[model samples]
Target: ISSLRDRITTLNSRPALDPIRIGLFGSSGAGKSTVLNTILGKHFFLPVSGMHTCTSCQVHVSVCKSRYYEAKIFLLSHEEWKEEVKNLLMLVESRHKNDETDNDLEHAIKALKAIYGEGAEEKSYEDLMKTVPEVTIPPSRVITLKKTEAQDLASELDPYIRNQDGVVNSSPQREQMQLWPLIKQVQVTLPPSDLVPEGVIFVDIPGTGDANKKRDEMWKESILQCTSIWIVADVERAIGARAHEIMVQEAINACQVGKCSDITFVVTKMDKIEVEEYVRNHQGAMGNITQHTAILETKRDLKIRKTRALKEKMMLRLPSDAEVLQKQDMVFTVSAKEYWNFTVLTREETEIPKLRDHIRKLYLDMKRNQLHDYLQEILGVFSLVQAYHSTQLSQDPPMRQEELQSCLSGKIEALKAVTTLCFSQMDGLLLKGVQSARNTHKRNIEKILM
Candidate 1:
């Protein structure tokens, strides 16, 4: 019984961040997906470039001993589904009345029409509210895919991720199934590799450009659970006002003030930045170089200048009151496309490999911390138990009935105090979480409604 009790205590003391969560957040076209692809060494999560994709969160976990790829989908709740349908109906009505075109709204209508037939698009607000059945989304789902069938499966899953029926022949179908909006989250499990650390989950959050209220709330909630965060941004535009606000103003708050160590700022698409003008303007002795040398010299100079500029810009923009900003590493500039394609020789200044190394180190540190915590808990538990056992064993003729009763009473009182304290702490934490979630939901509603 004592052994069983010890095992139970060990299980109870397990750390929450066992599978360390690394969250990725950025605006659309910021190369977040590209960074994700580079990290994974494969294009597992599809990137919806130049467009806002679905707001559903995508979680990628590495599955060991699984030879094939797999996915588990979590759909939105019934209330969320109804809210989406009503919003689409309202959007269509408003757009039609004003003779204004909204591709997103129209795309939604078409997807619904495909799923529920022609009446889906033509239904009035009241009719939709009455006719639409309450959707019962499963708590969890699992899908398996052979290596060869992964791409085909991704195509099938595109509508769910994109929140719209994919384009057909460069034109979207008027009546095609779109399941993306109905999904609250997706879990993609791939075979374990160097890119995916064991017992780590990578989260890809949709850009803030998405207008969905429910999705926005989910995004905020996910941030609270993350152990680390990566803020991906376009290299040229990363220091701009909007990106700065997101990184310095909002993301800092979302990651929790004291708990998080630092936020990693990843400036992506470095290859896209034109350096010809900078090269010509400040070439100095490096001028009159050959085409190859000029390109290399130009890239080198631009990288040094941009890196310094971005660092200075971030230092200026970061809140003086927030000490977390000072702990972060200097900005990392990378071209995921160039790295993936191996078109250009990767330089240390780009820092893609360095980022990977840092992630590995972070994982090791987290595991070491977890092990230390587990050891401390086990040691404390065993020490108390051993001391209690020794006291009982050393008792002369066992204690008298009155003495025993007094000892039992003291122990009971101590246990009661500990239990009460635990419950009180739990209650306070829970209440704070509830309040935070409520505030987040309220803000999302106001943003959407406005």
Candidate 2:
């Protein structure tokens, strides 16, 4: 009985399987959101316009087991908000003192306006600090919508996740507050699909070059948690110096520490090429083929050439120590708009389906490994039970009742000692964590005030 109990305890104490997270990264206007939407077969993420992004914080999407589309929005704690506001105020003050460039000032003011109201930066520091307490930050919330109400989820989350275009003030007559500035992250759960399985999480990270220090920390943390990283870029600029710098200088180290072996460089907007201009530029390669055939052949050749060139560039620019960049098929040129519109390119040509297959393969591989581990655990337990029964049957007199009781009592005492030790260790760790957090918070407050 004791042996069986030990086996059961061991099995129960095994950690739960963690979901496989794929982090999506890109510069602003790189169509990272569009790529995610294409892969998921749903327009869940709002695609923004040129030089701007709609995702203000990390947006994690996974398959929901239930019938409803659910969203959980995590809000920044009061201390975090206070620290960020103080930093912004200092930047604004520095700008005023030095008459520096307006870029930093503009960003700080925009963030302040998002949190408070329009013209928030014009106020004095004391006045702005007073409003911080009265701003009434919304608590983290979960919003669920039925399948019929799926279309409304975006609008519901807009205030929390989307970065609005212009400075919009809160209405004085109503209780309307823009919550995007306060949101730390958003988790969206969609109905289960074959393409995206339950244990695969797609994290849409904000642009890597964000000015906010808090956001920069989040980007690094998100990269650390990912099993795979996808870097999205415009097809035309996919191999540009900026893209090279970001991948080689900024992202490679985090990916290495995370032990993420899969890194995909996706160049989007492949269908934006002018066919006639391309054909004219490559007339020697086009030969004397008919116009219709020349166009088709030209597109195929261009895609192949671009894909090869991008892959080579990555291999050369990436450090030789980077295992993630070693794969031959790491680069993909896709057109999300063309895939959805189905105008000129075929579904296969668009490459969205191929990307979906890649994700599905990852999910299937993870599930297989988990299932294997579960089976091994079950077999281990079964062996323990069989050995216990065999030992009992081999006893000459089946053991006296007092002897059996004595054995059980000894096992029970051992278990009690083990449990006590575990609890003690856990309590110590918990107390240590609390003290560390308190010290860090105190230091941050002092720095901001000073």
lDDT of 1 at 433: 99
Query: Residue 97 in model 2: shift from native, Å?
Result: 2.5
**Candidate 1 Cα outliers beyond 4 Å, as residue runs:** 1-17, 43-45, 51-63, 83-115, 119-153, 163-166, 169-177, 211-218, 255-259, 280-330, 347-350, 394-450
lDDT of candidate 1 at residue 275, scale 0 to 100: 48
Model 2 spans > 4 angstroms off: 1-16, 43-47, 118-129, 132-136, 139-148, 167-177, 209-218, 248-251, 287-328, 368-450
What lDDT tens digits, residue by residue, belong to model 1 across residues 297-405?
5445545654565445445646655444444454566767767554554545446777777788667767787788877767877787787788778956666889989
lDDT of each: 0.62, 0.70
Predicted candidate 2 versus true structure: per-residue lDDT over 317-408, tens digit per residue: 56765655555466676888888886777788778888887787766666676778888888988997887788878947577799999999
- C-alpha RMSD by candidate, in order: 16.3, 18.4
Candidate whose lDDT is highest = 2
Candidate 2: 10-residue stretch with minimal lDDT: 167-176
State the displacement of the C-alpha of residue 430, model 2, in Å, after optimal TM-score superposition. 66
